[model samples]
Target: MAKAVWKGTLTFGLVSLPVALYPATESHAVRFHQLQRGTTDRVRQRRVNERTGEEVPFEDVVKGYELAEGEYVVVEPAELEELSPGRSRTIEIGGFADLAEIDPVLFDKTYYLGPADPATAKVYQLLVEALAHSRRAGIAVFAMRGKEYLTAVDSTDGLLELRTMHWADELRDPQQEVPDLPARRRDFNRTELATAEQLIEMLSVAWNPDDYHDTREERVRALVEAKAEGREVALSTGAEPEATELTDLVDVLRRSLAEARAARGTGPKGGRSGTAGGSGTAGTAGRPRTVGAAGTVRAAGRPGTAGRSETVGAAGTAGTAGTAGTAGAKGGPKRERARRAPEPPEAVEDLGSLTKAELYRRAAALGVPHRSTMTRDQLQYALKAAARPRRKLGKAS
Candidate 1:
């Protein structure tokens, strides 16, 4: 169980409920200490006077407001604390508005609100139910830790979730910050748009937060472990490819669609039929092949030709034709049973070949669980599992 960071009475109109706030999120980032290069000595930071070049004691350090260049107005800690917002036990709800009206960019840290006492549980549940039904968030102001905060409280799964918000002036305008950004609108062909939509549909899957993993943190941990084991680490210095202008939009869309279909196992196998390399026929004698859940096929040699003689499991494997299915005792044709097997666990590319940044992007897209604590191998495994097609359940008769 987690301890409550704040305890206060939440008030709205005539109703009031005692509530406790608990942090909803925590950081899992790896921490490092500063050290001198090629040495075991730790580098310590010290606050010193620039003029005297003498270290300042913690008790002597005071908050200083810079009035002008090289001039500061020093204020004692006790004086500053006295001037700050007074400690308040009440979170006064000033107004309520539609939750959707609030921009997500303005939201900051979130906290879970729970009943401070068993006697106040009923009022807390009442407020939560009201907010959930009304689809509105209560905007409030509260003083905590010598500072005042603007916050919004909304209902989430039968509980109140409070989020601290930034003032309007605090947010920076991207238009002002970014210079020479293209403002001209670009036109797209209808056919190309349709093809892109098809590609998106083929690649679309249900959102699952568990599928993502943070590979960078994992890499950092792995580096630390390797260094501890006295292992040498190799660094890559590959140049990034220059971006090329798209000459033919339709051709690019067509190629993308083809690749997407191939990945989904819906595209035609091999090249044009009777012209050279076609997947041949989908018969038992052709080649031993198995289809994955996502329609990916695995077989021996080329798609249209046979090669080695190896036993292929229902889980899809590359092998010879005779070994694919069981032959009947009376010289009967081999029965090729189409069984629902798990998708191949191999990644599209080796995890080691990708950079930590690239792995982190993939992990974010997949919504892997506990990604911040995962290692490179763990991230790779998680990504592979996330990329695998989900097994279809047979309809119950």
Candidate 2:
């Protein structure tokens, strides 16, 4: 059973419901022991009093804050209680705002609130049903552990969910940090714009929470478990590779978008393969067949100074092309057919590495529109701009 961390009243006008708050989530981070590398003995923390120059009982110690050099203000339990944010015994909800309007960075810890008494279950159910019908949540202030919390209270399945938020002062001003966009921007051509639109149409689907996974963390845990079991864990190189020549963006967009849209339904085992393709010629052709190559480039585009750079072009031939001997027709091995020889590796510029078609296809994946005529630099800039994660405000003190 989940344990309640707090018991409080939900108050808005005369409507009052006693609720117990329980943490809604738990961290799955790996724990580590501090140990001497040579001895392997775990290190333990000790408590010592400064003035007495002796170890002190854990129960005797009190929380203190330093105000001046070598000066401190020690507070007793009673004094601490007196200074705590005691005004909020009740979760007093004020109003509601569109969930999408929230910056997302403001959201912190989440707590689940349920009726404190079985008799008040009806009240809890009422709130949940009401919120579902109204499509609104309650904004409230609450307190726990002597700290005040600004939170959003929403009801779902007979329980109230409380998500704490950071203060306004905590959000960083991005305009002050990032540089202004270049003056001479490329304009989108009809084909580029049309393909970009088609890609969006292909990939568009209603949000579904189930369509996600933390593959990185899962892979890490799998490796950790393998090591713990004394098994040899080989690093995995994801997927096979092939190469195609860069072609028109229209076909690429169409191919990509189609796959994305097809992923929406309750159909295939894993929509990992389906999606609308971006519109363009040789849409998916002329590009590296493996996602690994493209993934590396995208990951490298972050703020840090470039440690290295990769250029993609025609690479060395990947063995024989369609030299198959006829098998089925004459009850023999199938005959190979003629195909374009794989291009040899050439030092292509970063811009050259991705064709206009490839750029539009990628821009479609990222939900950036008007991509057809977008220059390689524009495409790169847009990708970086769209991939920004929500900024967490005021890291916990």
RMSD values, in order shown:
15.8, 15.1
In candidate 1, list every pair of residues with a backbone clash. Answer: 209-367, 211-368, 212-366, 212-367, 212-368, 214-371
Cα lDDT of model 2 by residue, 6-40, tens digit: 89789766788898989888877767789988998
Task: Give me the candidate number with maximum TM-score.
Answer: 1
Model 2: worst 10 consecutive residues (lDDT sum): 320-329
Question: After superposing candidate 2, which stretches have Cα over 4 Å from the reference?
Answer: 48-56, 84-88, 96-101, 177-194, 236-397
Candidate 1 lDDT by residue in tens digits, 1-397:
7899989889999888888999998778889999999998999999999999999999989888999998999888777556643335778898997544566667888899999899877788889878766666899988777667899998777889898999889987765766864453436545555555554554454333443345467778988999999999875643333343366454444443443344343434341111112222122222343332323333332221221222223322122222212211112111112222222334456767876555655665554543443446555655665342222223223
Poorest stretch of ten by lDDT in candidate 1: 327-336
Per-prediction TM-score, please?
0.62, 0.58
